[model samples]
Target: MPSSAPVAAYPTSTRPVSIPGRKPRTQGLRNMELAFLVFAYVIVLAALLQVQLGVMGEFDFQLITVFGFLVALTVAMHLVLRFRAPQADPFLLPIATAINGLGISMIYRLDLVNPDITDGSVPNATAQMVFTGLGIGVGIAVLIALRNHRILQRYTYIFGAVSLVLLVLPLVPGLGVSEANARVWISVGPFNFQPGEIAKITLAIFFAGYLVTARESLSVVSRKFLGLRLPRMRDLGPILIVWAFCMGVLVFQRDLGTSLLYFGLFLVMIFVATGRLSWVLIGLALFVAGGTVAALNMEYVRKRIEGWINPFDPDFYEASGGSYQLVQGLFGMSNGGLVGTGLGQGRPDITPLAESDFIISALGEELGLAGLFAILAMYFILVSRALRIGHLGGDDFGRLLATGLGFVIGLQVFIVVGGVTRVIPLTGLTTPFLAAGGSSLVANWIIIALLLRLSDTIPNQATTRLEVTT
Candidate 1:
């Protein structure tokens, strides 16, 4: 037998195992980071209050209670989010909480100005507080239970069908509420439900599921003409049909904003997934044509266009006129030019639906231009983060879901802020997270939950895919 070669002893040194290409996951507490940010926000708000109320001598207990409650609820949400979704982006939840808190504060301030406007109510901050609690609870439940975004893909058609049913449900007899120039709400007992809010999320999921499977085919099956790549006419049939159907919904429901939102969101996701610009151009042309037609035919649409063009028209002040709300919104915003007239000082009562569509105007009036910019910056950051997460996600479904959700938020914010500022025709769309509607609140919270799920999967997604393949 040949003698075994002497084994060579290799020296070993202890060091953390580092993946060659991938970065190590950070262990910072995302929830704690969010809590600290929120705490800082409260401090800024308190400082503002100190300057306004302490200096001007207009402080009230109601304002203090509202701010205090918002801070408390934010802390509670942070606690719930800590254990539920530890890997979620630290900024999303805190930004959402800040927006919600600001909305409640604005609403409470408005209530103090004209008590009768709130229907003889003291303040509905408590109701919003309750809803925030419920929304956060639902968010945690979704994060804990769903486990993955792909699970939602299994029910894509079901969600779509249900969402469609809910969207059309308001058209049923004795169910819909025709308010704010649209019949989009369903009355269920004392609480009213906006089915469109739910519809947006469900349709988004369906869009993501469908697009992921078809992206490659759509990209390759294109006709090249004039040095531009366009999807084949046959391949475009489904998207066109969906667009027409959405247009029909807009025409019938008198909801141009949602129609624009859904159509734009669809086009964006498709373009991003397929890297196609032709679809975007086609969608824009269609939107422009549809907008012109609507402006010509619909009185409400025409009035909105005119209002945007000339909000300061004398005729707008007539009791039953188009510019009444817009003019009032302008006044409120102008009143809060720089640092705001203080939270409870500005006349937010001038604007109708100040707590919903025109909440930004109220914020501008009370919090000033600085506050308005801060709010917009928050939205920009949120959208940017969502997009970053989409790019980082390993799977097509996660990427599309996050992209679609981000598109929804960005588009909604643009539409609403533009409407309030009279930069575009007004449409009754609520601001995400900041608007005072239960459906909107719940929908946004669910969005946050989905993002958390996507973020959590990002680190291990590659290994999971490899394991499955092996």
Candidate 2:
């Protein structure tokens, strides 16, 4: 009886609980994010300092102001995420900041050596700095206000309308500004804006919301053709409309890059949402056919194609629309060799439009093949993380939206970088973040903002399971 009474008082275990399928989202990793920003700032500042010393024989004191401005802007956005988007991915902002900072430095370097700049005219670097601040401001506003990405779905058609308007704005009589044979820009007083840049973001939102609603019909109501599941004629309506829209952009807007980019984004998103390869095949067919037909008729298109085919040909160099820039860029990169010519030491300014269209070449000339690879690796990493978030996203709209946005970045990089490297035709597309353009910067930063917000909404499986058990 005494032994039984003594055995009745056992203690319970107090070990840490491990939920079977839970991965809690308790840690924000804000410190880690800030550390990356600091590292990126150091690299940017060091590069700029080298450029000043290498070319100007001393440090540009203005860079100190630029550095302070960028750091403050980044910190402001960081605080927004810390409070508003606590679960957002930590690396996106830092990566973007690094690319952007490097771009600004490169532009400044090019500006310092630009013999083309008139005595009283503003340097592109100063303008780029202003744009960077504006872009960061826009991004911060988006992050602080947008608590949920799905709210975009509510204005799906509205986004479509807005995108349409923006696209057409460049085609308007007085507003449209034709530069370098691409009429995808609008002039507002002294400032020229590429409305198509913003259009891409709005169109992605529209495509995501639209496809999610139509996925059922587009996926199941299809026929097998030549061992592939091809959507029925009625089900093919959306893709067909998209193809026509792409062609319209190419023809009217005169932007082969933007047209190809939009179509590619839609085609990939459709396939992802429906698990159908037919859409891709069909889209490629449409693009090739449309592009070939346009090339045969359009003077600009023909020149671009010919240039890509033989950039080094003297005919290409001496033509009305010569590939002198392309040839010059190739020579610059070739001169860079393995490591680099050391930032300010190279003749990056010799290439036409070196700050924007040929910025990759400018970067390649100074950083060399190894550095170019590192920069591309950063872009690939960002795209991979975005895809990861999308694949893990539970909601169809969020998944599609995230995936589409990621593709926009990936495909655009391919188009622009490929053009620079002679892997594809010159398409007048600016490199994201690294190229000098305010509209591109603003649009891209907004995309980063949306992606961060979406990541915040994605729940951790461990947290979900733990909460359920509790």
For model 2, the run of ten residues with the poorest summed lDDT: 461-470
Where does candidate 1 have its weakest 10-residue lDDT segment?
A: 461-470
| Alpha-carbon lDDT, every model | 0.77, 0.88
- What digit string (tens of lDDT, one per residue) describes model 2 on residues 297-401? 998899999998988899998786779999999999999988889899899888999999999999899899998998999999889988977998869999999
1-470 in candidate 1: lDDT tens per residue? 98797744753444444455643333355535665666757754764465346334765555566566556655665665556656667778777877776676665555555557556643555666667777777877887788667888888778778868977988888888866468788898888888888788888898888888888778874568787798888787767877886787788888889898889889989898889888888788887888889889988788778877877777765637668888888898998999898766667877888877888898898789998898899899989989988999878988998989988999999999998887778888999888777888888888887887787677643221111110
Q: What does candidate 1 score in Cα RMSD to the true structure?
A: 5.0
Identify the runs in model 1 with alpha carbons over 4 angstroms from their true place: 1-26, 31-77, 117-122, 460-470
TM-score for model 1? 0.87
Q: Which candidate number maximizes TM-score?
A: 2
Candidate 2 clashing pairs, residues 3+ apart or interchain: 22-462, 23-462
The regions of model 2 sitting more than 4 angstroms off are 1-28, 178-180, 461-470
